[model samples]
Target: MALIAIFILRKRNSDSGDRQSSNQNPQGLFSILNLEGKLVYDEIVRATNDFDAENCIGNGGHGSVYRAELPSGEVVAVKKFHSPLSCDQIADQKEFLTEVKALTETRHRNIVKFYGFCSHARHSFLVYEFLERGSLAAILSSDAAAQELDWSQRMNAIKGVADALSYLHHDCFPPIVHRDISSKNLLLDLEYEAHVADFGIAKFLMPDSSNWTEFAGTYGYVAPELAYTMKITEKCDVYSFGVLVLEVIKGKHPRDFLSSISSSSLNTDIELDEMLDPRLPAPSRSVQEKLISIMEVAFSCLNKSPESRPTMKIVSQQLRT
Candidate 1:
């Protein structure tokens, strides 16, 4: 009986040690939250009133969005996803694990910061730092915001997105591909710095992974090659980023122009000004040179043959120049 009591005490001690070590480790987000700070789940519930319908910001292919505030009086955006268990079990696990894994491990200025997540039998949600300006899509969609998005802001924002993508594709150990790179996924802070979001979730969402049931992207942003080919590669993201860059400068998606250039009948070489968004004036000499190079790189990324497209590292270098 004494021996049994000793064994139970030992087990309890071991369990307590494990818990204490976990809290001390500079990993598993206990460290990060200590640095930039953490938004407690209970406080967030109060801020958004438990994600009341009135607080909803937007809806997406997989989830609904809500705006919440932190104890520090800072606002944030949270995405609450519908249980994929109702539709596809495999996808639910992959997407939840993918975003959670990617954000937990990676951190950069251009990358969106993941505060934390909550997953239970009834609720699944991700918390992210809020951008006062909201998505690039919303800004461009509004007449006032589009008008205010001047050339300088536009150029910087483009570089911000490029830098973020480059980090994901080259800087990371295994590299990450942001399967979704549309305007909606690019959010800007008050200073107009762009942070890429909605990354690391794509393949699993496709029913036929080998050959996607469909292109699995916003209509205009989907790479042209996806029309005939089903294979997904990092270049697909490069292609999408290229379109996104042009869209930022042009104040809209560039589907018509992409189609025109792709047509066998039309000459690929066209005046850059011809495609400029009318809202913005012609680029300055330096800006013009930069825009020309960017457009060329965009063209290369949009190449129908995925092999022909330059890797994002190369694209990042070109943008820096």
Candidate 2:
């Protein structure tokens, strides 16, 4: 299998060299993927055993993520798109390009690093710096892993994500709406620090516009009002971030809890302890205060009214202090 991958990758590289010699820019679709060297692409193909299922670490709506270790001893996550461009729709192609653009253009500690990307004839994939701890959803789902994530770590993860979202919604020019913000999209490192990933559905908020578009987000994490409005806004990501905060603190999906609290009556009656995850012991006094503050901000973000939801920048600023 390894030898076969190498031969295939080498042939692909030779073919690419020939194409580059003939037409460097083929209809604006083919260009060097932000990095010099076709060797990186060849190495990645070899690293993943030609993207075999055994190398796959995770899968999402549009692609499967595989763990690849380069010859330099650095490991990376390779997301291989599944038939993303086969469709005639320009939007789908834009989404793919959007992800590449979003990652390449932005730089933040809480945002995943973009090594490079590949838009080859055989396969298309994006390479990202690997996070050892994997997705927060996977960690929180496992009792053993969840136990290792203490209150402080969980709190930091929430804050990290907030900062990242703030950078996207406020710091980035034209502003980027994640469109999809869920536990599955929040990756954790060895320290349990959160890094926002997956920008395939991200949209740029145009000036003097609502940036309205079709619904494109996870079920539970998507903002409630999006169903009626179908308008993509920064608030959509805000609502999803709120759900993530609760999920991290609670150590599980907060679907039932959210449902119960959606009614104004239950909102006031619900105790902090009741909403907290019972799997772990209650947070200490100092931690409790921060958690309380986080919960308050979270509820505000979850406001059914998009206008009522605080911007991610506000959320980030509050969490920082």
Candidate 3:
């Protein structure tokens, strides 16, 4: 019901307030439905100790995320934007609003849950469900954590992302394009289930509108065509998903593997064993076959030509099979 109310508000304000200036003091512009604006705001500030460093959980290009536990014992992640909008902060305001718009529209099990957002003159932030295991990048960086993420868990993570992307690209009206789909944007729960997070640079592909936009995405996961085309498409996400797949399998960013592939020098006969993460033992026979199939689908997604890349729908279907 809150999501539905937010959607209605977004539609009503689409033409005007959606692009409102960040410098303006728009007091009590809380977009959350069914929650008292001032009450939730007070709870968040009190819980986070006024966004102190001790409460901080994660930091990103857009803002820092803090762990907040309300008086009701509900835990949430709060992404607070840096104050005093100037130059880059102005752009960050746009990104912040973009994320609010995108997340408010999306609803999927594999996608991070969006609770609400607050836009006050003093501080602005977005609230989301707290995920226990943090990010895939953090997990892969730790040997102990990487070992804990067994082959079966990794497979589920990959499929969850594919399913989320498929829903974003096809199931949503005006199909959303998540320009950034790097491992850092993928969060895991206690069960190792993957959830897609971060939509600071996401775009909605509206019909009869040019989807051209500035280049944005993690360097290693960015699509090759973006340098020249300057266009946003679902294929950009597909390419990033390819990189994520290999990263999950290799236990780190596959920079060298990506380079070889880009140079067209990658050996087709390269053994799968060499690509797997060394921290974990080999997967079972059935799981290995699934991994092989997944790798094939990933490679197809990373094709130099955007048109040649498989749609997320196709990739999701392939993974399911």
Candidate 4:
């Protein structure tokens, strides 16, 4: 597990004295939410040049991501929320913050390290450890990068995501359901290690509360059951993980293959070699067997019936073996 350094910015009351306290920094820009960390609010604004377009690295449904390099020479990814948010967007921001607070209590190696968040009147955003390699989707889109991510690395990436999901589903107190698990949400570090990111729609499965909600998650990766049922479960993530595994193996989205498999009742006569990405050379016999095993696990996870899909814990254990 990685060490979490949590920092939060709170609006100081107008009546409050300007004098800095032990908990507040000299600027009084941020307060310690949990653990230790001094995330100077001004530093981020300057680092991102007031969220200039040149600093922007990625864009998502919720907000844009910017790369901010602090004065200390530390690089981090900043997700700046769109200001003047609509009523529904405000609700989503609240849920996003709540989820971040819960995640700070638990840390996993395969999960992205969240430094903290800011909620100033001017701008609002979340900070996370930056990965040089970027998202899995970006890498697969490039032929050179895809070839660099060989079979061994791809397998490890799949396992890392599974382990992270397992921890989130079974280890967390209330158990978090990562509503979105597409390749775009999976990031890779310099060493090709996978880290799960983007919790914009994540939900906690509280035992006594209803888990039903409006439809969420990426289109193709979303569980088929979600289209008809508003209720959410960990199985949704498992199904997305199945799609991700196939995507990583194929070096692209497996939309056609997935459609064919679902229609053909998961034809067992398909050749494993034919299914693999052609960009790389053929794997050895031992590697092929492992790939076959992984594909089997992915297929099981993609079962049409949510009840038939295996839990992330089970999927993680299967990948480990």
Candidates' RMSD to native: 8.3, 6.7, 4.7, 6.7
For model 4, the superposed segments whose C-alpha errors exceed 4 Å read 1-37, 84-92
Q: Which pairs clash in the backbone of model 1?
A: none
Q: Please provide, for model 3 over 35-146, each residue's C-alpha lDDT reduced to its tens digit, 9 standing for 90 to 100.
A: 5543377788999999999999889886899999888888899999877233346577678767877887789999999888766556778889999999999999999999
The TM-score that candidate 2 achieves is 0.87
- Superposed by TM-score, candidate 1 places the C-alpha of residue 233 at a distance from the truth, in angstroms, of 1.7
**What are the models' TM-scores?**
0.80, 0.87, 0.89, 0.87
Report the C-alpha lDDT of model 1 over 1-321, residue by residue, as the tens digit.
Answer: 011233223334544756422221233433433233365556667788877899888888667889987778788898877662332454554465467667876788988998776654455677888887889999999988988888888888888888887777777755566678999989999999999887546432223234343457777888777788867777888889888988987888887888776443324488887767788667789888888887787777777767888898888888888
Q: Per-residue CA lDDT of candidate 2, range 80-175, in tens?
A: 887535435355455666787678668999999877766665677888989999998899888889889989899899999999999998999878
State the displacement of the C-alpha of residue 23, model 3, in Å, after optimal TM-score superposition: 21
Q: Which candidate is the best by lDDT?
A: 3
Q: TM-score of predicted model 1?
A: 0.80
| Residue lDDT tens for model 4, 117-172 | 76555676788999999999999999999999999999999999999999999999
**What C-alpha lDDT, on a 0 to 100 scale, does residue 68 get in candidate 1?**
88
Q: What's the best-to-worst order under lDDT? A: 3, 4, 2, 1
User: Ten-residue segment with the worst summed lDDT in candidate 2?
Assistant: 20-29
Q: Candidate 4, residue 186: CA error in Å?
A: 0.3
Ranking by TM-score: 3, 4, 2, 1
Error of 3 at 198 (Å): 0.6
Task: State how far residue 140 of model 1 sits from its true place (Å).
Answer: 0.9
